[model samples]
Target: MGQLRDRLMRRWTTARWTRRLGAGAAIALMVLSIQPGLGNVTHAKGATVNLVMWQQWGGGHEKKTLDKYIGLFNKSHPGIHVSEVAVTDNTKIVSAISGGKPPDLMDLGTTGTLGQWAHDGLLQPLDTYIHSSHINMGAFVPAGWHAVQYNGHYYGVPFMNFNVGLVYNKKLFRAAHITHPPRTLQELDTDAARLTVIKHGRIVRLGFVPDYPASNLEVFAWLFGGDWFKNNGRTSTAALSANIRALQWEQSFYQKYGRSSVKRFVAGFGQYLTAADGFESGKVAMMLDGEWNIAFVKENVKRFQIGAAPFPAPAGMTSRNGTSYIDTNPQVIPTGSPHAAQAFEFIKWETTNPALAAEYATLVVNLPQLKHVPQTSLFKDPNFRVFENEANGPNAHQLPQTAISSQFATNLGNAEEAAILGKSSARSALQNLQKMTQQEIASTH
Candidate 1:
């Protein structure tokens, strides 16, 4: 994309987007073999390919950006029509694919769902088309394609990307008498204690509590070197001791102040976009969260001194350069689609054609998966480059790419909850996770 950066300053795309070729449109752009205007377009001759897309990353605005790509694709290739159905929620992709019906294309949110799909034989490999088109995989940022492969075949074509980090409040830290944000677990604990405020036996404030449900727990698990899977990611083993340590750290606050009290406070917490967020209302001193919240914080929470840093680690442990990242959304083409060939043609044009990628990305904030696309003002922020850097950082680990990854996540969650509730020890949880995950993998086959 470095060359794209050069072309970008002029605000022009390196690829052409046009319905009719006047002189130089690439032969890569193909209309439906079934020519249109002969009969009702209800049938599929030369008609535009119908595409159903699932948008998993970014906020609502991200969906709008993808839709704009559809608009551009439609305008440029009037012969090939594309229809998009909006679906977010990165977690449910397996169900969507395994439910025996899947969209023509979907964004797999760096969730490792693409790998799983490829392994399950649910996704078609595009190597044939890619090689023929001379598409350079090198143009995309590494993470965009790293997790897209499983057992040597690639199922997904990369789209947008993201990375998670720590976001906190400067005003809240100052009020808690914390001069510096925590860099280690000890400091994190000390800051949490200072930030905790209780009145009438009711908790008024708490520190940045690790919201385990949100994938931040994975970062902590990585810290302890205890992964959620076993056997090179063919099975789940979420009950690892590292996982237990992480959960213990996560639940430590509730244990310190009392879960009941914390629950009561949370029950009354207000809207997330408004003042209800702990960082927004001065209710929390720190947080381990994602980058999108940056826009939300800047947009919704005003008059508060906010800042972000890498998550603090335990003593002698340095928070790594990147994180337990799930970035790079996956765009897949469903099998048995009537417009398979046409759909593929549109995919090649939309993803490989720098013009549509640049135009669509202009409105979307996520990093474009297409190689050579530039980071532009279209993202609405200059600091977003930080997220892109983080995605390329070493701390990132591809989530287990297997058909049962979704189920493994579920089992891993149970192990996490068991430890959180004092129902089991971390060691036993890990062992049980291993056993159950192995069973699930065998059963799925």
Candidate 2:
């Protein structure tokens, strides 16, 4: 899952390039589609159209799997030749598109910037091609379909997706006298407290690290019935009451252990995907992670049994019990590509083909973007089944699709960090974020 890891790494740099793009270059490109000589490029009759494609997965099984598929695509579609290159740095993508020379196709890892990219005319809409190709939009998971759309237009295709859940060490739970994973938020807190182990006035084994390894405050916000945006992703609602409650809940974990103590503990944690990783090393008992973690544990961890369950919702929120944050690896054709038609041809074949979609998802351990893909042996993995159910659940959702989505996520992360580290109250952090993001959105228009 190198591509998945690459997507995760985007969190560190999103606020930089994405922020600048959202504020500056993106604004300049907002009217690019209306410019003459910028229309979609089509191929001549029976002529081969060559396309350059870029993606984040640099090497390993993930890249090889994609290469295999691209090979298959090239072989099948003789009229279109799609060549892929591993380009992990997003700034290069921005530069290429802004300079009017962009790859025909690209997989941007996540939908975090889909809205901004589409709104700024960096990506060409696929609605016409989709309609002409008879692509069944209903074949996708609802959240996956939603993630690829901005302003009622389809700008990208979600090929691989996953939703997060609670993963716990069964051995640790049994030792703590817990028979089952928590099914409600209250039980989660109690179990975390019970499973935590302290020694020499330091945390040696933590019950849970709310922000460890990834950003999950958004998941908590979903569970608490809050969202960062509403009214079809046009307005900022960063300080929604439910969102504030979720932040408070996340901050409580840091408050339970002193901020300095928690910070030091997290600082000492090993790099993710390594043997010394906190969860893999048994230094952390519980975590909120995507379905890919199931395969990671199966391949990497041998010391204990790992269990996965739906992330708990607040008490009495039965309707929200199975909620998970739906995330995707979305592919798009940049505007002004010389081979937009051929690029769509290849993307359609890669994403909509049942056999290929199933194979790709299995190779990467991702949920197939299509809903009715034929099940393979991968479905038999119990932990994966838990996430599969969560992905199909009604409450599963992606982040709001807005032109400022990338910046919104960056601001939200900052707010969560401030609140969790005790630099400011949750309400104050969120309220301030609300005003700033609202202003950013307004300026974009």
Residues 1-445 of candidate 2: C-alpha lDDT, one tens digit per residue: 4423443454346564665455465458455432212211323435676677888753266788988999988888887777777876666677567645577889888888889888888889988988998988888776777888988998888888977889999999999999999989899999999999999998888899999877788888888999877777668788999989999999999999888898898888787755578888888899988776665666576766889988889899978886788878888889757667778888888888888788877777889998888888878888888888888778787776788877888888899999998999999999999999989988988
> Each candidate's lDDT (Cα)?
0.62, 0.81
Which pairs clash in the backbone of model 2? none
| lDDT, candidate 1, 90-151, per-residue tens | 32444344332355565555645565556666577876766777767887777767667666
Off by more than 4 A, model 1: 1-46, 88-102, 110-112, 115-121, 177-180, 212-215, 235-240, 267-285, 299-306, 319-322, 353-364, 370-386
Please give the distance, in angstroms, between residue 1's alpha carbon in candidate 2 and its true position after superposition: 39
Worst 10 residues of 2 by lDDT: 33-42
For model 2, what is the error of residue 194's alpha carbon versus the real structure, in angstroms, after optimal superposition?
Answer: 2.9
How badly does each model clash, as a count of residue pairs? 13, 0
